[model samples]
Target chain A: MRKYLLPFLFLFLFVFESIFVQYLPTEMFGSDRITVPRFLIISILFLTVFSSRKYGIIYGIIFGLLFDIVYTGVIGIYLFSFPIFAYLMSKLMRILQTNIVMVSLASLLLIVLLEIGVYEINVVINQTDLSFADFASLRLLPTVVLNSAFIIIASYPLKRHFEKFMASVSD
Target chain B: MPQFFLNKRLIILLVSIIVLVALIGFSLREREKVTWPEQFLKDMTGFVQNALSGPTNYIAGFIENVQDLQNTYSENQELKPRLDKLASLEAEVQRLKKDNAELRDIVGKEDALSQYEPIQATVIGRNPDRYHENLIINRGENDGIQADMAVITANGLIGKVKNAQSFTSTVQLLSSMDPTNRISAAIQAEDNKKVFGLIEGYDKDKKLLMMTKIPYDAEVKEGQNVISSGLGGVFPEGLIIGKVVEVENAEYGLTQTAYLETGADLYDINHVMVAKITSMSAEIQEELQSTLEEEEEEE
Candidate 1:
């Protein structure tokens, strides 16, 4: 049961992202800016940095597939993008310092990449007609700001938890 | 370059990219219904989502109730006059409904296009990705919901069921940018005249529905109520869609287009009713079937 905590955490974030985040009053933004909570991916990035990359990639693939199947019409967008970003983040972390600020910055970078990648794919598949300028202003900027705030609040606790879990698993 | 090709990680990356493209292409194709695997997954996720959102919805509703309390005095003052009118209007509607039914009985018309069974549903989850603009509802095929059934709130038409799983259905909002997302709508002109057109697309920036293909000379003015025409044979007739906001010439003056402001707030929706067209006579059903076949052949 204790071993399932990480996966449970991911699942909670996954469900919360789609369900509860919507209840956050959009009027708070005062403009029609799309703020998608990529908390699941942010936590997954934390797992990659603090725990094992192998487990992170596995969790990414599983949750990514779930996200695709449950939320979006098209499959493989999140399925492909999530694990790829997890892989890329792991590689980037190897070269950079593993401080909280550095990890948060890296997570934000991954979030931007994932957003742009998904946006480009949607454009290619003609799922959206939003121009790049509009996407940047309406979606990308707001999403980055929202997720960065999430990271700022969540990173310390998540990192400490993952480190403790990793130690226990190794032991 | 040679070493790059030799690397195992690069090979996995290239292979996965190919797989991704293939999966995307497969999912993008038009299908009559979602496959069983997709359906099963949706049901599983939807069950969890339903359970999770129930408490959250209650909390949100409580907050909304508190907000409503603050404006209760002003709202009551505004609605007291309307309450008297509503009583008379209800009586008039009942009288008219009886008269219309008697007339239809005399004419041997047992079925009407405006008939539908409303299936109550609660939104369990919305697509976090804003691009698709989809909602997952608690009701599904088990509740007699089918693809293309109009989903509406108390205000007006919101969208239609994109697909129905066993226990959950996906609603594609009218605001989604899909070329094939068209609805046959009619503008209620003065003197009970209706000018027909198709709601072709959504103007995202302006947040309005675009009703197009109106004849250039049609007298569609601003503020006219738009309702589903029932010519598409999917959505029931007289379901309020929106009110026209602006009109302009299109196709080099061959046709006109009108922008409509939807009554339903597409952003904040919790409950919806799937308008399941009910009790159509055999003749009308056959006519609809033949028209559908003819259109398919034309395509």
Candidate 2:
């Protein structure tokens, strides 16, 4: 049961991201629709940074596939993007320091990359029609800000869990 | 670690690419149907989502109510006059509806115009991806919801059912800028002659629905109500959509375009009604359109 904590946490974040995050009273933030916080993606990134890149990839594929099947019209986009981005972020973190601030900044940059990558892929597939300018101002900026705030808040706790998981694996 | 895992990363990359392509191909098939595995996942997650959303929504609503109280006094002052006017209007509208029904029966036409049955549904989830703007509602095929059924809130039309699973459905919002989800709409005229047009797209930056293809000579002005035209069998006639905020010439054509501040709360909708017209067949729709066109031509 203790071994299952990390996966259970990821699953809870996934459920929260899909259902409850939208209700956040962000009308005070702006006029446009508030991009709900991507807690699931952020947690996956934390897993990637603190644990093995391999764990990140495996879990990314599992949860990413679940996300695709549940929410999106297309299936492969999230499944492919999540793991690839997680792997890339883990590689970047190897060079950067692993403090909360550094991790938050890295997580922020990677999320921007991930959203833009997804947007570009969707544009190529003719699934989305948003222009790059609108995408940046409306979606990219808000998502970056909101998810960065989430990272700042959850960074310490998430890092602790990741270290515990890593310890358990080595043991 | 097995001896066969020498090129693990390379194999993983290859496997990911193959899986990605296969999933995309399968999803884009002719029917666009969900496989059993996907359906099972959706059902399970939908159940979980429903369970989680209930308490969160209640708490959120409570927080919102607390914040809204400050403004309620000012809003109440504004609504008092409107309430007095609305009571009179309500009685007059009810009388008119009965007379119209009697007239329809005398003309040997059934109540095709106002014969939609609405299924109430709770919105359980929304796509976190801001670009898609799809909503997941709890009522699905089990509640007689089908693809293309118009989903409306108390204020106005918001979206239409895009897909219907066994216990849940996905709604493609009116705010989405997708070209495929055009709504047939008309501006309300004093003389009751429809100024028909298509709500062709959306202005994402301004958060407005874009109405297009209006006749160059039609007198479509700001502050007029826009309603679904029932030109296509997709949405029923007389469903309130929005109010026109601007009128302009089309970018490259002879037609005009009107932008509407959609009446429904696209950002914060919790519940919706799916308009289901059971008797709306292609043949019936064609007949309805032909008669409507004949009436317009005579006028």
TM-score on B-chain, cand. 2 = 0.86
Chain A superposition TM-score per model: 0.95, 0.91
Best by TM-score: 1
Question: TM for chain B in all models?
Answer: 0.96, 0.86
> Looking at model 2 chain A, which ten-residue stretch has the lowest summed lDDT?
A20-29
Per-candidate clashes come to 0, 0
Model 1, runs deviating above 4 Å: A25-30, B1-4, B295-299
Q: Number of the top candidate by DockQ?
A: 1
lDDT of 1 by residue, A47-118 (tens): 988998998899889999989988998899999888888889999998999898999999999999999999
lDDT by residue (tens digit), candidate 1, B252-293: 899999999998888788899999998577888898899889
All models, DockQ values?
A: 0.70, 0.57
Candidate 1 local lDDT, residue A87: 89
Model 2 lDDT tens row, B1-299: 66567788878888878988887877756455667787778888889888888898898789889989989999999999999999899999999999988998899776475468989999888877655778888988899988889999999999998888899998988977566888889999668878999998888666688999998889888899999988777788889999999999987759899999889878788889999986576778788799989999999
